[model samples]
Target: MSTRLGWTAALMLSALSLVPARAQDAPKTWDVPMGGNSYLTATSADAAKRGGRNDRWNSPDNVTSVYFRVDRAAELNIALRAKVPQGESRIRATLAGKAVEKDLKGAETADVPLGKVVMKAPGYVKVDLQGLKKTGEVFADIEALEVTPTGKDAAAVVLNYVKDNKDNNFYWGRRGPSIHLGYELPKGEPTEWFYNEVTVPVGSDPVGSYFMSNGFGEGYFGMQVNGENERRVLFSVWSPFKTDRPGEIPEDQKITLLKKGEGVHGGEFGGEGSGGQSYWLYPWKAGNTYRFLNRVHPDGKGSTVYTAWFFVPEKNNWQLIASFKRPKTDKHLTGAHSFLENFADRQGYLSRGALYGNQWSCDVKGEWHESTVARFTTDPIGRSLFRMDYAGGAKGQQFFMRNGGFFAENVKPDQKFTRESTPAKKPVIDFKKLEGADLGS
Candidate 1:
């Protein structure tokens, strides 16, 4: 059996005691605007499924081209949203008289690439798109289109393995990192592998966001971003049993917090460009397998693991429990950094050590299971956290939950338990009740 979940990691130091508790209210409801324009439109015809006909095509030709006349001379960003298809295509851009092209390579079909078509002086520009040939078939589905002003540097960031699809209850929330990017699992089709992608404007300080896949059974997933140091940063998580969305976490399944840490801007946390943030924390309930993900900032430089704490009932003190199993696997990867997750009473913490390889795994059932995987950025700012409440630890283990935290160096630890021993209050968050909160930009 497999389980999947999505979450975020943030780091904050201080809080207003006796202060107005605003963040805990509820998410406000917001209306998402319809993106209808000549520049972008949804292509619903010529639809195909995985291993179905027309599945190899990146996107219906109808939505692939942006129809715009060049006024003077400017660089435009061509954003393509495609679920994992079957093959790769070389992405190209061209004007009435000029053209630029790049190879967009991948294994499955959901790789999203922000291809750029530069229009120089007085002529019309048309960006062309195609995939490169590889050992396996691969394709990308085109969704939204965006054009941005690129100063001299006109390279578009190509994103791969996207999870945005139709039928999802999506809405526009905040800008930058506070922005919430999510999707509701489709009811009819069984999702093979879900992917998600977000581009934080060129330069922005990202706080952190949440990834919640509240569904029964385990849903395998991951997150990645391309920017300064694309291959250095890494984040991942998993769910052992099953449950509903974050708003529906069961009372009996609420697990304790484990450990928490912050990866600051200078050392391994921050890389090349301007310093960034890194965080690690894990939240879990007993006997559940959750999907794990890893994401990178569109503009930050660095990555690190964050703080962790287990969710204890009534009593607020973070203590260690021996009822859950640690993550284990025989699968491994090359050139990537990895972590092992567990709980110390109520505190969630990832061991200080991580492995680098082309393949990696969390030991489980005294045997190794091959894992579905993805890659991450190098200059990662923030940390990765893992959580689980199962039946064993280390050596022979079973994974109950694994989560990743990014740009979370801003969230402070939970306020210290009140001196007066009050029963541990359950954290209250209800999406149905928060429907009145404003979510529109």
Candidate 2:
């Protein structure tokens, strides 16, 4: 009897082992944009299941659909988390051209599974939702579409989907930039300085404006070249208090203009309580390679100082742009990024491009490190509203972002960067000699 029981227990254990284990990781959720041009929508509300808000469409005539792109072929478990109001109603859903129908009765909210479909390649997943029958005035409230991956390649499928589809608002109806290098500091770990080199090929036509900014809203420094004509290096610090114009900006909120290049103007800019000072209109030439350096350090008392410096190969040295002090704060730098954009009225019908590389950062402890991998994103206003064509890619050893106007096909972000073993050498600049010298030419 004991031998027979052991045999039966062994058989049961083997059968249990044959059953597959459920995926332990939480599924990634993507928020569907309902108001944009690509997403055909009737109305939006504060009811959201995933993000913060959702949309609603009334009646059968008002139908809505969303088109999403993916990079791999895999099976997707798509479902709609929605609330059905009124009597029994028919809800039709389509995934990648395949259609399914479901009937909802009563007035409760539920997740309606919309059948699985195989995405054969890197392409769009078109989901359409409409009500076939509505007994009451209200039809449905769509919280969001819950898309879960199923099968052996589920992990790869989710990764490919995220990589192919980013919330890039600047490049509408187009693939993302081929390559980008971003060094995002670990959350809550801020740095004190950033340094990088940018090269604009001779006679490079910039569409509108390009910016390289380090730090964020509280304090920031960087440079901007507008329309390949206007060039300026900018630095600003937020005031402890909030207000707009220069006159109302407190003295502690202001960065004294110590020195500036010829034709540079220093004053306040921006709107509302979130304003900062601007020192711009400096002369910058095309086809010239330049170095940008920024520093954010705290003052002894209760303020922080933000400074910017620029180096032109012609000058062979670093020159200070400006420095501002922010009152009562001990914070390091945050949100470092570089972008190429066309602020022209014609939008992305034209093209402009530039090359940026050799990005490095220094922590508050004075340790230096080089940044390698970067995630690519775009301007939301330009992509959805203007419908422009923005392209980013790597070529050789350089990475570039281009939009508006014409760009050469070979321009890409393939530049190779060599890590420096030693700390960066400071440039030789005599502040004493520059203090009185006529810089504002």
lDDT of each: 0.24, 0.51
Model 2 is weakest, by summed lDDT over 10 consecutive residues, at 1-10
Give one digit per residue, the lDDT tens place, for model 2 in 270-365: 553444455566566656667777766666676666666677566666666666556667666766666654433322223455676666777756
Write candidate 1's Cα lDDT for 1-441 as tens digits. Answer: 100000001001111221244453332211111111112122344442221123234333322322333334665554443333434455544433355554555432222445556555533333344433333344333433334445544332221111121222111101111111112232332232221211212222111222222111211122122212231122222222233332243333322222222321111111111111222223332122222222111111121111112223344332221111112211211122222221111111111111111121212122222222322211111111111111111111111112222111222111111111112221222222321111110
Please give the lDDT score for candidate 1.
0.24
- Backbone N/Cα/C clashes per model: 143, 28
Question: Model 1, clash count?
Answer: 143
Cα displacement (angstroms), candidate 2, residue 286, comes to 3.3
Q: Which candidate wins on lDDT?
A: 2
Each candidate's TM vs. the true structure? 0.20, 0.48
Task: Supply candidate 1's per-residue lDDT for 303.
Answer: 17
